[model samples]
Target: MEILKGIVLLLLVLVGFTMFSLKMPKGMKAMGALAGAATASFLVEAFHFYVGGDLFGITILRDLGAASGGMGGVAAATLVALALGSSPVYAVLIGCAVSGFGILPGFFAGYVLGFILPKMEEKIPDGIDLIAVIVIAAPLARLVAIGADPLVNATLINIGKIITQATAQSPTIMAIILGGVITVVATAPLSSMALTAMLGLTGLPMAIGALSVMGSSFMNAVFFHKIFKDKSTTIAVAVEPLTQADLISANPIPVYCTNFVGGAIAGLIVTHFGLINNAAGTATPIAGLMVMYGFNSPLKVTIAAALCAVAGLTIGFIGSLVFKNFKIKSVAEVRGTV
Candidate 1:
């Protein structure tokens, strides 16, 4: 029951974000900024703090990681505000105001400021507008962040705990679900990194997310090669699915279904080895694998990673064959190069 509830809640969040990205104004830009913030903060923390600091005793790197992690909200607010078309000055101001908040709260604050600041700038004279922002916008941004913090903890954090507990109780089932879902998200605009960070996933669930996405690099590479037969497109997808997001989004069924299969297979392999990742938001390909070494044996992580690669390759090939006849939009078609 707990697992079911977690899955439902997770689905709702993903779907809601998807709808926002598709329907809301500047939503896709905001989400892209969020992904960048996650990479800047969470990925840095995973590599430096967990892998470098915990594993190799690098004090400077550890301190750097700690600082980066704590500044997630600031990064999110600034980047998101800029993405949403705020001036750089206003964006940084909003970010500073939301310094102590979580990423989601900062995102909310930035989003609100993005719209309001532009209107304020239009109505008020230049210097007076700056004063207005200092007195009103900055405080308002912090308040928005403060208001959002508790809700984020209540909903997203609790859902993460429920999902992690479900993994403890039924590793196999949770592995398949989380593996498939998170991998699919990697290819989507919502971004697996942002989702995992927001949910605060760690432990076996985090491991499943990390390695499964690592496996997907191979899967998407092979799948895109088979489908598009374009060297650039294939390479882009392998490096980062978001680079080819429009192409992937245009051909969702084959890409998403194939990723689900590959991710599920990788998840099973990870669960079999009882791998764990204590890093909360390292659900990325390279950093994901790197962080595993902090929590598990190096040899064991390497072995599991190799198996996942094989699984991804095998599924990618088989899926390519299965979907050979499916109609897909060519890179040329999507990019209007033809």
Candidate 2:
């Protein structure tokens, strides 16, 4: 029952949020805000790791980080809502009221309130907009959060458990499945880092996911070399494919078809060699490959990653052949049409 409920919530949050963003005007703007804010929210940990500052036994730092993460969600939602034509101050206030859920859920919640708030403001008399926002929007937002955030958390926890079980029961097959899924999620508007964090995915599963994501990046760079045109753009997209979400999402066939192949190959190598990642969110090529340096011999890690890249390259070659049949629209053209 619990697993079923979690799956249902996962589908709702994933599908519902995806459709809302794609269908709504300026929805991608909101998604951009969420991504930026989510990365920024990790500043506290980043600082502690690099700078090593202490306030009230470092617990203060954590509290500050939590606050920043929460506010980041609010700010992201506000930016999107305002872009959708909500009033400025009201948008901010309502954004604050509505977005206590984590980044993605907060985005969906904010999108809903963004449309509704304008209608609500219109119904009210003059001179009391502040009251309306504070009294109505604030609590209503909390009410939404109370119901929504728990569902999201529950769904994430269940997903994590499933991955854990898979790794234990059938390592190779699970590696391919999870690797491909995580790679797609990472490249998509969804948060792969956040998903891994929720799952606490580490060891072999983490290694597989990291390799798959990196391999997919290599495949993308190779398959779209003409569009990328330069080393810098290719590298950037490899590290983070969200940079080209518009193009990738617009023409998903080649990218996804190749990614599945690359991901499976990477997964196979990681499982066969017993490669593992002790850390989470270090799933990018360099970061993912480097994490294994200390655990295994540097030579071994490099070879494993290189093999994954080779596999990705193989698929990219196949994808290129497949893509020859299509018109192969320019990235700019896709962006313009969208």
Candidate 3:
């Protein structure tokens, strides 16, 4: 029952993000900005602070990670505002104002103020507009962040808790569910990194997310190579699916279905090995693999990773064979270059 609830909740969140990207004004750009913010903050913190500081005894790197990790709100606000066409000065100002807020809150604040700042500038006189922005926009951005904090906690955080609990109770089931879902999300605009970070996932669940995604790198590479037969497109998808989001989004069935199968197999391997990742939001490919060494034995981590990669490659090959006859959009077609 808990497993079902967790799956439902995660799906709803993913669906909500998809709807936002499809329907909201400038939503895809906003999500991209959010992913960038997660990379700047959570990824750095996870790799440097948790792995470098905690495991490797690198004090400077640890400190750098700590600083970056705590600045999620600032990063999200600044980036999102910039993505939404806010001026650099106003974006940074609004971002700095929401210093202590979480990423989602900062995102909301930046998104709202991104639109409002322009209107204010137009309505108010030029010289006075700066003052008006300082007085109104800054405080208002903070206020929006404050308002969003509770909702984020109630939804994303609670969902994380439920997943954690479900993992504790039924590791195998949760492994398949989380592994597949998170991998699919990695290919989507929602971004597995942002999702795991927002949910504050750690321990085994985080491990599943990180390694499963890392495994997906191989899966995507093989699948894209076979399907597209384009060296550049295959390399791009292997390196980072988001870079070729247009291509992937245009051909979702094969890509997403392959990712789910590969991710599920990787998750089972992770469960069998009892590997763990303490770093939250390290649901990336290279970095995710690197962070696993911090929490588990080096040899064990290496072995598990190798197995996951094999699983991913096998699935990718099979998926390609299965979908070989399916119609697919080329890079030129998807990008409108043709």
Candidate 4:
């Protein structure tokens, strides 16, 4: 109880600090608000896990996934809702639906939905910056996803099982790798994070870890590539939102080319390392990393992350070249003609 109170106080302080920061001319309001809320949410969920585990049946790991996913979902839902002139209730309902099964899904349910809802939002007269609305929704998104996960899980599992049975292989990759792919496969209509979380539940962290090791520089490459190769102001801001799809949408050839190189390198390193995703519901390397940072397999985990970076960078480099030869120029052209 004492620990819980301390945590609450800390979170409240962070929130208050963030609120105050928003008044500053140089302070980044969105990032500050998110940091504050995330700190609070993290503390709240952590306490729930530490103290309430026996009583509430919450695992610290899963709880992390739920909280983060819920936060992302709520934010995304609210953004989509505001952008599309829909009710927050409905947006949150769908956000929960996106959070199906595990933590990654919970987080991503909102992300993919943000993309999907923009078209609808564009239909409305008073639509706003989808990202801004998402910023508003960020804190509560994960909670919404957590609340809606049971229904989402049931439906996703049925679908995953059916797809697995129908197809020879399932697209079950870990949080980062799979998340990267989902980030690429913009039209697949799958929730990237949600799918990754479900896969995580099946105990594939080693594989994911391996890939992360293999593609450690994937995000880094994104950073470098944007700084070097990308020529657009609108698309260059990839790291801020952690979105490659938007880049692809803005300048498809460069992004597409980058994906192939990045993905291939990632696949090779992951397969070579024989590492798999840890069996957490949300397979973000960050999550497993936090849990086992100083644990028994720290070195191996680090290696796996390095490989993931390699995978993403190598694939991005090569894929970008390939994009130059592709039939379409802009992502809009690719989609519009299709």
Residue range 1-338, candidate 1, lDDT tens digits:
87788778888889889998889889999999999999989899999998889999999989988989998999999999999888999999999999989899999998888889889989999899999999999999999999999999998999899999988988898899999999999999888999999999999999999999999999988888998899998988887889999998899999999999999999999999999998887889999999999999999999999999999989999999999999999999999999
User: How well does each candidate superpose onto the true structure, as a TM-score?
Assistant: 0.98, 0.70, 0.97, 0.45
How many clashes show up in model 3? 0
lDDT of model 1 at position 305: 100
Off by over 4 Å in 4: 1-83, 86-154, 159-180, 186-191, 198-202, 205-244, 250-254, 271-296, 320-338
Clashes of each: 0, 0, 0, 61
lDDT for position 118 in model 3: 76
| Model 3: lDDT to the true structure | 0.91
lDDT of 3 at 1: 95
Q: Give one digit per residue, the lDDT tens place, for model 2 in 304-337.
A: 8888888888777787877767765565577574
> For model 3, how does the per-residue alpha-carbon lDDT over 24-63 read when each residue is reduced to its tens digit?
9999888889999999999899889878988899999999
Candidate 2 lDDT at 308 equals 85
lDDT of model 1, residue 214: 98
lDDT of each: 0.92, 0.65, 0.91, 0.40
Q: Candidate 4's residue-wise lDDT over 132-204, tens digit each?
A: 4455444345555566567656654443433323221333323333334433332111222233333322323
In Å, residue 325's CA in model 3 sits off its true spot by 0.8
Ranking by lDDT: 1, 3, 2, 4
